[model samples]
Structure formats: structure tokens, C-alpha cells
Target: MDTGTHLVIGLGLAGLAYIDPVVAADPMVSTAVLIGTVAGSQAPDADTLLRLKGNAAYIKNHRGLSHSLPALVLWTALISGILWLVFPALPMWHITMWVFIAVAFHVFTDLFNAYGTQALRPISERWVSWNIIHIFDPVIFSSHVLAIFIWSVHLMRPEILFPILYAFLALYYIWRSWTHYRLESGLRPRDPTYEPGDRYTLIPTVHLHQWQIVKRKQDGSFQLGELRNRKINWIDRVSCAVHPAVEASKAHPNIACFLYFSSYACAELKEHAWGYEVRWADVRYRHRKQYPFVAVLLLDKKLNPIDSYVGWVSDSRLEKKLRMGGA
Candidate 1:
């Protein structure tokens, strides 16, 4: 599931029972639920982080800790406890309990995948990344998107179908996972690379119409080795990002945060609401003396992107000209 799908599904599950009650009851509690809906949203992408650092150790260290039930419970309790300690007059229990319930449900939902979550970790250092649906399943994600769109424009109430649809999705994946496992079991001896270890994510490559397994190698390192896709031999050679084109962008804190917050696939550091700061190469304008282009953006706590058009800045040549004038 994608982050947006996690959000939608989390919201759907949280609101399933309490929607009518919360709406009719105290407005504050309703707002709490809304906040909960917004939180616990990002899809389980602990696996993707492995690719980012080009290793499994980084993901393993951080993934289970933050993504686990224990962490979620402790965090929620601490939040509630602090609230209660600070404002003893308020009913912190309701707030804390609601948040816990919502967030716990969120963590629980991640179990359906081939990479199930590290709900019970330390005792088990395994990282879960389930294979129920592709991490970026357009079909599953679109359902959440369509439902969210309907909610955004219209007063959409929680429907039973959401749960049923979600349940079916989880079950279907469970069955498919078994089938994949059976196929994988039969073929592992033939394919010497198929040593099963923890933190494995089995993803279905859609174009090839076959299942592929990405397992953590015994060296405690994760490898994206090909597995069980020989039936449909078309394999993608495209590897993950080797280098990030953000050296210039990294120099500016504002631009860096904008990159984090705005979720712009690529961020530019050159020009903003205030003025021009950094420069980079891009397709729109390839750093000429005359033409100037810049964009501004903001990112939220959840790293969702928001973009704003800002004033342009001088190109490098013009900047040099300005420096000469000042001198």
C-alpha cells in the first residue's frame, strides 16, 4: 500500500464505528478523530529505506522501533500522560485512548502484507514487508483516492464497503502469498540465490505477470536479487537512485525543508519568495544570462508537498554582473 492508501484505509477504519457518534457528540472529540485520521497515514515503506541507503541494516535498526506496536503505545501514552500532567482538568484519557486506538489499528493493518510489521520486535528482529499488494498498487491506492475525493467535495459518511473491501484485499493477498510461497519453495533449490532470510518482501512485478522476491541476504545485508520470475523473463535493469541531484539544493536549509515538505520529486534551490539563492540545471531553462526561473515550495509534518510560484532571481551571469556593480 502507498502512503496515501494507508491514510485512507486508516481513516476509514478509525471512522468506521465512531463517525456518527463523534459527529453528533462533542466537536473537540470529532476534531481529535480527524487529527488521528491525518496521522498514521504513510504506507509501510520501511523496505524502501533499505534501497535509499543501499543496505538493510539502516532499515532494520530504525524500522521496527518506530513502526512497532510497543513504540506506538508508549508514544501515545507519553502524549496522553503529559497532557494529563499538564492539564489535569481535561479528560486526557479519552484523547489518549482514542489516539491509541486509531494508531494501533493503523499498525495492525500493516500485518496483511508478505512483509508483516515488527509488531513484536526485539524478541524478534524481523522486519515485515507484506506482499498482499504491490507497495504502489494503483488499484488499491485509487480506491482510497476516489473515496477521499468524494469526501473532500461531499459530506461522505463512513461506509461498510470500505472494511469489506479492505478485508477482501488482505485475505486475497494472504492466499496469493501462500501461492507465491509454494512456487518459491519448489524453485529455491534450482535457484541457489534464493536463501530465505528475514525482512523479505515479495512483490508482484505487474508487466511480467509474475512474483519476485527481495530477501535480506545472510550477510545481514539486503540484496535486490532476482527470484522466481524466470517464467516471465522480462526483467527491469533500472536500479534505484545512484546519486541525488541535490548538492546545490542541500546548501540551502529553506530549500532542503521545502524538498522534504513539498514532496517535489526534484527540488531546486534557486529563487524563492524572498529572492534567488542557489542555482541548478534543469530542462525548462539551462542557465542562460538572460532567462531567470525559480519556484518555491513547503512541506508538512507528513512530508507531503505544497508548491508556490515565487519571483525570479538573477542567473549566474547576471549575479556576476551585480557583484561587479556592487564592487
Candidate 2:
């Protein structure tokens, strides 16, 4: 989920904390729980600080260790401990429990989106993306906003209303998951070449019935399409052939980082007067017929990297940069 969604959800969780007798009994404890909940909700993303190092570092580590099992425990303890010192008289266990819930919820919700978290680290480092929801689902976000509004205006009891809202959201997730499963299962029969073990990446859009699907072929190419009304409309094929230039460019840190972060990466090599330019892209996300999340690397005649960039770039800006020799 996006930062704003996470923050609003955090606020909603704080409101939900009113169900606890200890939290409801004392205003001081309530305030502490509020702070702890909000902070814990945003804590795992503390890896955003790695952006100062570079996009490569940030992309590689953003949801890796920070959202792992160990990090969840650390974030809960750290946030609760800091709040404890501030409010030494409050029930420490209640604050700690809510903070832990907030942190765990943040990680859990992240698993449902395309950019998933490495929440199962040590046990497994695989990026567990359920792809059932978009990064910012208006339905989810607006529901929270509406609930917060109602809570602020004292229109309904927090404990009563929030549990109902969450229950609905839970059902919504299950419906989305069923839709995703049906779409994925249907694709195998439609495509003649689809083998049993081949990988398929489905990214959900804000619209309930729309999804972007990527089917990885055995030959390292991707079949991209959009699923509408349970039917797939083929888009384009992105080649991931093992070109020498593409292979050579992988040695660059930017390319390496892009490969690590992208689940469906495809590389294209172009020759220029100065040198070679290799463009690597994640085919999972396509907008307006463009793959915006990419890494571009320029290499001299000897295939030595001259310059490289790893991040999201607009189609126009990317073409302009490539025209200027990856400037």
C-alpha cells in the first residue's frame, strides 16, 4: 500500500483500539496507543531512508529486511519502548500489543499488492505478492477515510463500526483473491504453450474487473495482456533473450538491482555511434503502452559500463535520455 493509505489505515486501527477496556479507560493510554499505532504502521518503511544512498539501494532493501519477521518484532518493541518512557504510568502491555498489531497489519496488507514485502525472511526471501489489490485501492482507502470521518464526527461507536468495516474489507479481499485465481486458472487453457509450471504474474488495477497479466514463456519472453470481464486482450510480447550485451549489462549494479526488484524483467540492446545501450524493464507493469520501471545502462565498445540509471522513468524522458546517449 502507498504511504497515505498506510497512514489512514493506521488512524483507523487507533480508532479500533477503543475496544480495549484499558485503552478506553484512560485518555493518556489512548493517546499513547494512538501514537504507537500510527508510528508502527509507518515503521517498516523506515527503509525509505535508504533513498539517500540511491534508488538501487532503496529498491533492493525497501521491503526486504525491514518488513521481515525479525524487523516486525524490532519495530513493535522499539516503538512501544519509546512510548513507554514517555508514559511510564500507562499499561505497557496494551501499548505494545496495539503497536505490534499495527506493524503486523502493515506488512500483511503489503503482501496483497504487486510490490510485496519479504515478510517471511529467514524462512524464505521470496517476494510474496498476492497481486489481489493495487498499491492504492480507492475502495479500501476511501472506506477508511469515510470511517475516520464518521469516527471524528462521533456518528457511530468506533468499536462497533470499525469491526464491521474490517469484516467487509476482509470479504472484499476474498472476492478479489477468487477473481485473481479464476483469471490465472483460465489463462492456462487459453494459451496453447502454457505449461503447468510456467510463471504468471497478474497485477490488479483500481477497477474491479481489470488486471494486467504477464505470462513468462519457456524461451524467456513474456506475453503481456489485459484481462477485462474475465477475457484477456493480448497486448505485446517482451523478449528476454540472452543477448551478450544484455548479459554484460547485468554486471552493473543498477541492472542487478532492477533484476532483483523486478519479477518479470526483459532486456533490449541497441547499438549507437558511441557505444551500446541496454534497456531492462519489468513487464509486470505497463501504462499507456510503456514500461516505465526500467534500468538503462550505456556501455562502450568493449562493453564496459559508462553510465547507468535504475528507477521509474516516463516514456518521453526515457527516449530523450536514450537519444542523448543515456545522459
Candidate 3:
């Protein structure tokens, strides 16, 4: 989920806290809980500040350790303690409980998106992405906005409205999961030639009827396509064999970091007038017939990295940047 969705859900959690009679009776406690919830919601993502160091550091660490099991406990305790100091009259237990809920909810929701969090870190570093929801879902965001508006207008009580809204959202998640399962099952390749390493990954788009699909083969090739109204529209196939240039480029920091972050990474090696260009891309996200998340490395004839970049850039801009000698 995006920051806006997380914040709105945090506010929704605060509203739901009013179900407790003690919180409902005290205005100061309610205000204190609101602050705790909102802050707790955004705490895990504090790792976003790593961008100050560079994209490599940011890519390697964002949502890696910060969204782990240990981080969740730390965020809850730190946020609750800070709020408790500001509102000495409120019960510390109440503050801790709500803050814990808000922090846990943030990690849980992130598991459904394509760029999932390392929520199971310490136990396992593997990324757990259900691939059932987009990073930003209009339905989830707008529902929270509408519910907040209704609460603001005093059309319904917070305690009553939020519980109902959350129940509907829960059902919505289940429905989305079922839809993904059905689509994946229908697309599963039954050919005996399909190697054990071959697999299909379905990534949801903003539109419910549309999804991005990646078929990764054992040979390090990828078939990118789109699923619309139960039909698969094949888009692009990236078939690149192992090459010395591609192997050498992986030693560069930018390319290494991009490989670590990308699940369906593919590399293309091209000989140029100056040297060689090794283009690595994550095939999971395809927009406007372009794979924007990429890492490009220019290597000399001797396979030394001259210059490199690792970030999101459109195909056209990437070409311009390469032509300008990594400007």
C-alpha cells in the first residue's frame, strides 16, 4: 500500500479504537491515540530516508530489515513510549496496544503487493508477495476517504462505521486472492517439457480485469504478457544467453543491487562503439511496452565498469542517457 492508504487506514484504526468505552469518554486520550496510530503506521517506512545515502543503499535496505518481526516490536514500543510521555494522564497499556495494532497492520497489508516487505525476516529473508493487489488500490483508498467523510459529517458513529468498513475490506481481499488463484491455475503450463524451475507470476494492475504476467523459464529467459478479461496477450520475450559481459557486470554495485531487488531479472548484452552495454531489467513491471526498472552498466573492452546507473527510467530516456555516456 502507498503512504496515503496507510495513513488513512491508521486514522480508521483510531476511529475504531473508540469502540472502547474509556477512550470514547476522554477527549484527550482520543487525541493522543490518534497521534500514536498515525505515527506508528508510518514508522516502518522510516527506512525511506536511506535515499539520502544513495539508491543502492535504499534498494538494498528498504523494507528488508525495517519491516521485519523485530522492527515491528521496536516501532511499537518506541512510538507508544513517546506518546505516553506527551500524555501522562493516559494509560500506557492503551497507548501500546493501539500502536502495536497500527504497526502490525502496516506490515500485513504490504504483504499483498508486488514489492512486498520482508515481514518474515530473522526467520527467513525471502520476500513474501501475494501479488494480489497493486501498490495503490483505488478501491481501498477511496473507501477509507468516504468512511472518514461520513464520520466527519456525523452521519454515523466511528465505532459502528469502521468495523463495518473493515469487514467489507477483508472480504474484498479474500475475493481478490481467489481471483488471482483462479487466474494462475488457468494459466499453469501442463506441458511435460516445462522444467521444475519454470514458474508463472501474476501481478495485479489498477484495473481489476487486467494483470501483468511473467513466465520465467529455467534458461533465464522471460515471457512478458498481459491478462485481460481472461485472455493472455503476449507482449515481449527477453531471451538472452549467458555472456561474459553480463557475468562481469554483475560485480558492479548498481547491477548487484538491482539483481538482489528484482525477482524476474533479465540481462541484455550489446556491443557498442565505445565498449559494451549490459542492460538488466526486472520484467515484472511492464508499462507502455517498456520495462522501466532497470540497471545499465557500460563496460570497457577489458570488462571494467566505466559508468553505471540503477533506477527506474523509461526506454527512451535510458537510450538518451546511454548515448550521452551515462549523463
TM-scores of all predicted structures: 0.49, 0.95, 0.94
* Candidates ranked by lDDT: 2, 3, 1
For candidate 1, report its TM-score.
0.49
lDDT of 3 by residue, 1-327 (tens): 899999999999899889877778888888888998899889999999999987778887888898999999999989988887888778878878888999999999999999998889899988888999999999999999999999999999998999999999999999999999989877766323355777888899999889988888877788887888887877788886488999998889988888887777888888876788898888887878888888889988888778877778997777666643522
What's the CA RMSD for each of the models?
13.5, 1.9, 2.1
Cα-based lDDT at residue 227, candidate 1: 50
> With candidate 3 superimposed using the best TM-score fit, by how many Å does residue 92's alpha carbon deviate from the native?
1.6
The total of clashing pairs for model 2 equals 0
Give lDDT tens digits, candidate 2, residues 183-275: 887887776556766677778988888888888877788889888876778889888656678889988998898888777789888888888
Tell me the spans in candidate 3 whose CA falls farther than 4 Å from its real position: 189-198, 319-327
How much does candidate 3 score in TM-score? 0.94
Q: What C-alpha lDDT does candidate 1 achieve relative to the native structure?
A: 0.47
Across 39-134, the per-residue lDDT of candidate 1 in tens digits comes to 534423434564455222332343456566577776576555655565555445556666676567556656544334677675775545545545
